[model samples]
Target: MELKLPEIPELSRQHRLAAQEQLDRKTKPVGSLGRLEELAVQLCAIQHKVPPDTARKRILVFAADHGITEEKVSAYPREVTAQMLANFAAGGAAINVLARLMGGELFVVDVGVAAEPVVGVKNRKVRWGTRNFAHEPAMTVEETLQALNVGIELAFEAAEDEVDILCLGEMGIGNTTAAAALLCLLTEAREEQVVGRGTGLTDAQLEHKRAIVARAVARHREWVKTPFEALCAVGGLEIAALVGSMIGAAASKIPVIVDGFIVTVAALVAYHLTPKARDALIFAHRSEELGHRYALELLEANPLLDLGMRLGEGSGAALASFLVEAAGRILREMATFAEAGVSEREEQDVT
Candidate 1:
């Protein structure tokens, strides 16, 4: 199948200005809310609503297995991918807990888990798992396009459900290695600059993982000319799906909360594919992963939280959704100075 990327329209400047004006008139001092105020304006602009409806939040966790585990890159075994999907279905994972606490619905899609389909999870498996990229391309162009379509289908389903905001997450063992390779290729960063201890690899293991990423990139760099080709070269199924999800969400005009390093790598691909997708993305946090900083820098994104979080599965995004909702509520519910009958600052008192 030909992977035709959806066209994401640019966010409206008028809506941004209107939201900023409303925020300035709020009872609090101008910009006192800091990033929260900016988030409100962004939400308003994306949704074209004065206060942006954040009533329905959905977290989509794409699960897959990475054949790179054959390289011993991750501290966890490949079986953990399927195990985590079952855990998510059992409502025992960190994301499940956060989604429940934050009133956000959690859905898991088995894009390529290398196992039988787990009950209670959406089955959209493109393959058993991505091929090991250390010696070969991770996925064929057709498989990559199929994975992307799966994500696009899910995003449209969320739109059908009237979800106001979407959060992107993933559960794929050894995916960090895939993400690191893709990051190195996309950002032209050295292996050390983009490789990190995934699932707590020791210093020596981390070094070995870096070498593997270096080798993989060296093998594929010459032919990986475009973002799509880069994904096919070194990206995992879940990563490609997340890329599609961002594009589809942007096309649907629904803001997406991007999770950590792996998800951020997917965001980088989506941004390169369609720069306007950045307007529909809300970065959730800065992961402890070393490569996350490079991905964030590449996208010029300032995430909402930075509590040294590296746990994927949308945990960071789930926490950040509360802030997104709070920003919307602040714009919708907070009383303006005039409505509250409060005195404004003196015209000469700029400070």
Candidate 2:
């Protein structure tokens, strides 16, 4: 049978209803808990517990280089991709800083940067970097499999640690071009709707980048008929590895919080690879990337943030964690109406 997108987490509707019923019994006006009550119920389902708690969060950043840099699609240089890996390892990158603030650990993987693997850094690079897609296929199937295996191995390590929640991020210049190209291939969007200025592009540069991606997609339109094949054509190693991370999270039953465009594109690829991954994921945001909303819509996800953020450091997912926390608190810590000795009226009267 053909693969289908992963199921959303099998939250107990009965249990969620029960939790909400208890929330209704809280000593406050009906629906007074606002978003927290909703969050609590969401948490209840993900944790498979009446209440949820995110005690340990894990953020995985897959760093790599895209061959499309040869097309001048990004403002940052390809060398920056490897340099940022060091920044992440040294806890100086934006994602690392955010993880520190949230007390979450940051793990960086060298999926496919073009440079030799840095010393003292975890070596997960499948290759130095993928070949430029402008002239040839981005990666061979063997390389893709290697990249996926690397991601799975890292995720298995996290699962062994019992990470409660997972966030996916990536570091690669010219990566957004790959994502946009993937969007055009995976969704009903076109070049204009999917392209965005990644890391600051001039208006002229954005147009140039868009045309390059459009040309890339046009060249590969035959493969565009299916999602996974399309990703294989233009997707970066870090992006592909992120896809495997999503798959590993689902297989391990850990909730996966997707970052912005690059990570979400990886998520899209993973869902196609194994549909069940959709069930264990939460949308971290409606990203600023031009194609992010299209990808989220294709997944039928509602992210917790829409700060016009296009920064792809798993930072958006980190911010969204606060909402997940609120949900857990309401489910696990809120006092019910009867417990608080508050008065209650009929449901008809409350509404």
Candidate 3:
């Protein structure tokens, strides 16, 4: 089944101009806030409002298992995918803790766990796990479409809850292997350029992982013709869901703060599917993962933080939520020069 792609909302040029004017009138010199100022403008354009309101937030942590895990590409075993989802549901995971601290409601989705259901995770399993991509396509085209549809539904539900911002996270063992393959195929990147030591794989294991990615890309070269095809051939269930969520958020006029490497891989898929969705994505951080930087450059995204965070499951996005919320507050509450009775310097002099 082909995806019924939503009509993504257009960024409002009028609101963007208004936001720039407001920032210039603020007490600080023009462009003093640098990227924060750019963020405020982008947020305003995204919400189609003069000053954006980012009070409500939701983080969706998608868990799935990858057949590539069977290859010992990761240090952690495949069972950790389900265990981490339970930890997330119990509020014991890093993402859970950070989401709570950042004031974001957390939702765990079991897209393809390869195990029995966890109590608190919403079971939306496409399959127990993907087929091994090293030997064949990871998923059928229909399964890829189904995963994307699930993500769109989740985003619409969050929008109904009045969520102003949506964050993307994932927990799928050996999924990094899937992401690396997708990146290599989509960007025509060398396997060594994008593959890395996922979950602390030993040097030899990392090399083996690279070879696996290379083999997958070579075997599925024809399937990389389109974003949907690339996804079916090498993408994980969680990664497909992230792509749909991003597209849905764009359609709903809500910003989706993307987590790290794996999440960015999904973002790349979303952007490739609908180039406009790129406007709605807020990259949370630059992950320590080697492929992340290349993905970000391809997306033209500047992440909000870089604390050496490579842990996915939305922890990075949740932490970056604080900054996104702060941007809205800064734009809404900061005093204008006229209101503050402050002398304004000439535009040329300020710089």
Candidate 4:
């Protein structure tokens, strides 16, 4: 199936100028917030207003299964995916607690899971997970499109509700393996360059995992030509949904705060599909994963922080959102020197 991108909603010039004026008046010197001013500007574009107000924040934790788990590359078993989903719904998971503290709604969308999850457990199971890619393709092209549609719909709903920011998260065991493989195919990177120890793999196991991914790429070289093909060849359903969500956010003009390696890989594919979408991205932070740096370079995104975090679940991204919010607050609420009737520097006369 051909990938069809949605039409973008254009913002008026008056609204952008107004947002800029508001930013300049709030506190410090012009453009003092740095990229944060850019973030607020993009938010204004999405919201079609000046002085973007962050009234609602939403985090979408996409849950999916990875077929490559059959290779025993991951330390955790596949069942651990479903188990963590339960933990998330119960508010026992780390992300759940963080989300609660952050005062945002946490939503879990089940694009695919190997084991059928209970419907009432704060999960949306799309299918019983994807097939094993070690033996064959992870998913058919049709299924990939469906996953993208799900992400697009969810994002549009959030935009309609006036959500100013959306953080894309994921829950999938052995997913880093899939993310590395996908990154390799997209960037034409060798296995050794993009592969990393996901969730603490033994050295020997890491070598095994890398070799497996290398061989998988060689096997699907033909189908790995385009971004969609590469994703179908060795992509995680959650990653694909993230790609879709990024696209939807851009099409809607909302800002997306990206997390770790897996989520970054998805954003990479989304940018590949629509280069204009680049303007809507905010790199939340850098992960401890080996390949994350390479992926960030490929996207030309500098993360806001580097906390040595490898935990997926969008933890870093959620926390970084607060910083962006504070940046806005400081720009908009803090008193400026001129406003306080302070005199300018004597050097100003020389200039």
Candidate 4 on 180-293: residue-level lDDT in tens?
988888877998888899889989999999999988888888667788888888997888888888888878867788999999999898878877666677899999898999
**Native-to-model Cα distance after best TM-score fit, residue 41 in candidate 4, in Å:** 3.9
Q: Which run of 10 residues does model 4 get worst, by summed lDDT? A: 118-127
- The clash numbers for all candidates, in the given order, read 0, 10, 0, 2
Candidate 4 stretches with Cα past 4 Å from truth are 9-21, 30-35, 45-48, 119-124, 335-347
lDDT of 3 by residue, 148-240 (tens): 988999999988888999989999999889999999878879999899887988889899999888887998995567878899999999999
Maximum-TM-score candidate = 1
Decreasing lDDT order of the candidates:
1, 3, 4, 2
Question: RMSD for each model, in Å, please?
Answer: 1.5, 3.0, 1.9, 2.4
Which candidate order results from sorting by TM-score in descending order?
Answer: 1, 3, 4, 2
- Which stretches in model 3 have alpha-carbon errors above 4 Å? 346-351
lDDT agreement of model 4 with the native? 0.81
Instruction: Tell me the lDDT of model 1 at 286.
Output: 97
Between the candidate structures 1 and 4, which one is better when assessed by lDDT? 1
Q: Residue-wise lDDT of candidate 1 within 54-155, one digit each (tens)?
A: 989999999999889999998889999999898999999999889989999899999999999999999999999999999999999999999999899899
